[model samples]
Target: MIHSVLEFLTDELNTFIKLKVGDPTTTRIYLSGVTNEAGIAIPDQSLGISLINIEEERVNKDQQNRFVNAVGKVEKRNPEIRLNLYVLITANFQNKNPNNSSDDYVEGLKQLSYAISFFQSKNVFTPENSPGLGSFDPNLQKIVVELYSYSFEQLYNFWSVVGAKYLPSVLYKIKTISIQENAVLEQGEPIEQIFTQSQHKS
Candidate 1:
């Protein structure tokens, strides 16, 4: 489910960028991170969406785990876990010439700005609004994206943990992904009546 959500975002953002750049078949946005086998924090001349953190949304939890099935049998299942993913989008574009790297540097900033604009225009995604999302995961009913701000210290710590230098980037909080399993922990037949025991006075 997490993979599907990220892929959906990447595809949507990539389309928006292609339209803005007036180029078809332009693939720039991708699901990636600073830490990779190649040790490249950011790919050259592309935007990488990375999952930086995940937090469980503890508010408004459903504790009810038992329900009657269609066959009138009692069934018990664990409640789903709701999660919020902190995603970082980084743009890394560098020119071949180290001396003339300013152009690519600015280009990276422009790409990053495009990402911000795309999310600003449309932050909430539902099946009604985004039909493609249905193909990704029918269970994915809704997704909300919000700009996440960070303090200078926090930013520094993040970059340090990533083991890479900072690039033009933005952070977003992707909300409310549910995880549940179908295995029933317990099952039983529905009780139809209550039995009473009678005893003599002695």
Candidate 2:
């Protein structure tokens, strides 16, 4: 499910960027880590979408463990675990020329800005509104994207932890990814009535 969401988002962003640049074959955005399995940095002239962190959402958690199934029987299962993912979108565009380094740096920032703009305009996505979203995950109902701001100190610490030089990037908090197991603990008919007896004390 996690992969499905990220893939859909990456594809959407790629399409958006290609249209913005007026090139149908442009593939500027991709789903990848800041570094590869060999710890090599991302390629140049690309935007990488990486999952940096996952935090459980504690508020308004579902407590119901029983629901009516299609067969009209009540089934019990564990509640879904809601999560908020911290997704980092980084731009790694640099001109190889030493004298043109500043210009290339600005280009990276510009690409990053396009990403920010894309999310700013459309922060919420649902299968109904977004075409082909259900193809990725039929169970995925909706996804909300919010810009996550961090202090300079926090940013520095993050880069240090990642063990990579800082690049033009933006962080977004993805809200409410529900993960639940399909194994039912129990099944039974719904209670049709409640029986109680009250007797006067002797």
Clashes of each: 0, 0
Runs of candidate 2 exceeding 4 Å displacement: 37-40, 97-103, 198-202
Relative to the unseen true structure, what is the C-alpha lDDT of residue 97 in candidate 2, on a scale of 0 to 100? Answer: 64
Clashing pairs in 1: none
Candidate 2 per-residue lDDT, tens place, 16-111, comes to 888877878868888998875565366677789999999999999989899999989999999999999999999886666656653387877877
lDDT of candidate 1 at residue 173, scale 0 to 100: 99
Question: In model 1, how large is the Cα lDDT of residue 118?
Answer: 97
Least accurate stretch of 10 residues (summed lDDT) in model 1?
94-103
TM-score of each predicted structure versus truth: 0.90, 0.90
**Native RMSD of candidate 1 (Å):** 2.4
